[model samples]
Target chain A: MEEIRAEFSRIYDTYNGKIYRFIYLKVESREVAEDLASEVFLDAWKAFQKGQNPEPKIKNVQAYLYQIARNAVSDHHTSKKFKTVSVEGHMDIQDTGDPVEEQAAISIEIERVRGVLKTLKDEYQDLIIWKYLDELTYPEIAQITGKTEDTLRVNMHRAMQALKGRLEPGVTPEPVLGT
Target chain B: MREKDIIAKFTILKQIEPRQEWVRLTKQRIMGVPIHERFGFIDIVSYPSFFRISNLSYLVRKPAFALAAFILLLAGGVALQVTNQKLQNGLSLAEEEYQDTLASLELAQAQLQELRVAVEDNDTEKVSLAVKSFEERNAQASKDFVKLVENSSKKALQAGMKLVQLQKEKSQLERVLGTTLGEEKNEELENATKTLIEQELSDLENRTLTEEQQQLFAEAKAAYDDADYATALEKVWMLSQ
Candidate 1:
């Protein structure tokens, strides 16, 4: 039991930030994200105590946690606790240096892209967040989404196309770059 | 915007993060305190049940419950401090045994080094005196270890004790290796002892060993009497050096 708790604590320390960020990006409300993210771990802990952790038993912890966080966000979407987009939860864009000026410009561009990314469907948002941001591999993404790697490749292509369409006005549509 | 720019902008969202305090609190609520064998020293700020910080937050935030929480914490703190004091008091025997054992281990390792050099020089009298000194040190270590190993439920203690006994056997084997092995059985015994001791002392003999062995032993005793034998074993190697 002691070993179990210590191991889980290590797992929590490793993945909490990423899990929290993923939930926050999807929900866009810090309070709801906190509630749901904590809920995700609590749920994971329960599964873990039952020797039902998908990690160690099957494959990787990253996929198992993202799967839990994704379901947690889905549960919140259907629940009364979720808000559309809380004004208080608006992200404070941070960074700087002519190098500073360039950084600030980049930050603003990131926010602009974030706005457009938010406009995309949640599934598209998840793909972009996992692929381009989290940089998870196709197999890892497959474990979380329970989709085939080929299907994820196709979805990622579409998500990237949709994001690129919003970010650029006049761009020739392409379905595959990294895919 | 280009294709690269779109990908870069999306990637920049990686910087988005929840507040650190929220993360901590959420983890506390989600994971409470980790399970340790026991909390001695000033390890955890709260006692087991009373300071489950997660369970208390909502109640503690209530207007009526703040003073009650403070008083409960104060009482828990006092009780924990008293219990820890008793545990520290109880640690004296283990501390003494560990310190004495560490001394014997350090002495044995130094004597082993002396024996090895004496053997290399083929100095019979010097080798004899070193072996005699090592025999005495090995004897002392055996006594220290017998008491120490009795308290210890460590595979490491068993392995370490085997190494020490092999040192005694080395008094015989090196004598044989110093001259020549008697028969097939004696030759095998000499070979095995040298191999095991050499393997065990490979990393250990390289150190300029110090008082850390005592502390490591006592910590192993205090931390996990049965569990942290590997640390105790490391301390044994520190001496076998």
Candidate 2:
């Protein structure tokens, strides 16, 4: 039991930030995201403790954590609709030695992208966030989303296209995938 | 913007991080360390070997004593199993109560929406039906609230507040329809709504709200004053959860 606790402590330290960011983006409330993230880890610990003989061992812990986070977010939305607050002012974007005007432009662009992301379907939003923001590889996303890599690739292409359509109304995105 | 530009912007979201306090607190909780340990009982139970006999020579010299120790350990194990079973049952019951409260709130909201639409259309018959459904669900919710309080779940107060808000809306609806409905019908609805609201408010007033709950309640009131019923209801439900 002590060994298990040590291992879990290590896992929590390693993945807590990524898990929090994943949930924070979806809920857009610091309090709710923190609460949900705590629940996710607590649930994971309980599951680990309850495991007995013949229970399947978790192979990919990061993907497993992401899968748990995905379900938690899904359950949250099913229970109640959340009004996504703008992340622009709430975010703590570090200064990269850029000029003031350049930083302001970046903030504006971030806000615009957030607004457009909110308009997309939840599945597309999840895919885009996972692929772009978290930078999860296709197989990792596939494991979390329970979709084939091929399916995810197609979904990603369509999601990007849809996002382009929303961000720039008159411009059509070129198809990145060949027939 | 191109997909690459979007990705670059998305990268900014990674800057959001969990507070250091939360990370430390969560780890402590997962490790079963109480925030405040008034006694050493938890430590003894959590690490039983520390309290157990470690002297091999002492145990080897007395077989009967060893047998007695083994029997005592077996009995302790059984007792622990029974205690665990009771704890599991209690948690399961609490979860069921939480789900019931959520379902009742949801039903109440749907009924309220229907009442709003009916009132807007000025359909007396539809209004009456909506009111009847609302009253039935509201009464069930009240009963559930009482059960939850009896069960001693902290959520009972929040659910009771929601019931109070629902009753307030019912009173407003009654007042709006009073001029058109018969005096007898208006009086009946008014009396029922008033009694329910009074009961819930009395229950709420008896229990002091925590500072956090007080803040939420104040925010909910502000939202209500602004006529944002949805946000008000959301805050109240959040308090309940």
Candidate 3:
């Protein structure tokens, strides 16, 4: 019991902030991030008590965490019952102070990228974002995405090619001077 | 292939921020669970439901357990501090012995040189006896030098061992720390400790060693020329300190 208390204290001291930041970045609101961060710990606690995380033999703790976060996000989306809240109802965007505007600009860009990402299959979107945005390794991504390394590599290649094809004509409408 | 396109896409993605309310709601829901359920800190206090009537007393014993845990943590911290001080004292003593041994070596070397010069100048009758005396003294100084070196090496090894132990302890402590707070909230404290220790160790070692070692080397050289091997060894030992 003493050992367990000490262990809990140590883990809490180390990871509390990083987990919060990760959730905050994903959710983009302090309150939401705080909530998700708490849930992540709750999930971690349950896993620990059940002895389900046996030294992370299959997936690293970090990867496991992202997986949980992904599921949470997915559940959040689904629990809304696919009700497409009208654009006019999105009052979260009403406040347009300079900082908020700046954030909105960045979020807008992210949304645009997400829209394009929606064109691809879920696996492609996950793979591309986990690789590029989250910067997870192939093995790590494989653990999270449930894809083999070979498949991840092939999909990544295909995803890049597809994105390139979509983006090239729009970005490179004119020839360069050197060419 | 196209950096521009990739950057554009990333920029677009960055703009679509997730609703902040989702994080808030998630946190609220998560916090609704008991602390033990939050990160697996083995909350025997809150887990009374798992056990039958026999374990009800154990669950009711949380306040006492929490108090005991707090006391134990405080004791551990105190023990760490005490161990640290003991190590520092040991290092200081080893350093002092090393300095004394180096000074002795230098004194012996200087005496040897003086004896050699005396023999060359046909002052053998006068300095041959000095030579014999110095040789005996040199042997003693050499023994001291060896002992000093061994002592310093042992001290270094002990310090390294302690560091390894501390690192393990830190790792264990980190896991406990990580489970308490919500994820992402505790990174600052962790990073701060890591950075402070890394920076301070480098700075302290550099500043303490450079000037001290140079002075001891100069003293050792002077003692060597004076035919004082004992003094020379002591000075060299000081450099290590």
Q: What do the candidate models score in CA lDDT, each in turn?
A: 0.62, 0.66, 0.50
lDDT tens readout by residue for model 3, A1-179 = 44544454455445555455444434424455555666676786556545534452323566666677667656655666424433221212222223323544654544445445556655666676666655569988887777799988888777766666454333431221110
Interface RMSD of each: 18.9, 14.6, 20.6
For model 3 chain A, where is the 10-residue window of minimal lDDT? A170-179
What is the DockQ for all candidates, taken in turn? 0.21, 0.26, 0.10
- Chain A TM-score of candidate 2 vs. true chain A: 0.74
Best first by DockQ, ranked: 2, 1, 3
Candidate 1 lDDT (Cα, whole model)? 0.62
lDDT of 2 by residue, B87-142 (tens): 67766776788679768976976897898899899886787677667655765665
Question: Which stretches in model 2 have alpha-carbon errors above 4 Å?
Answer: A52-56, A80-112, A165-179, B34-241
How many clashing pairs per prediction, in order?
1, 0, 103
Kindly indicate the candidate among 1 and 2 with the higher DockQ. 2
Q: Candidate 1, after superposition: displacement of residue A71 in Å?
A: 1.4
Looking at chain B only, the TM-scores across the models are: 0.35, 0.44, 0.33
Docking class of 2: acceptable
Candidate 1, pairs of clashing residues: A97-A100
lDDT of 3 at A175: 20
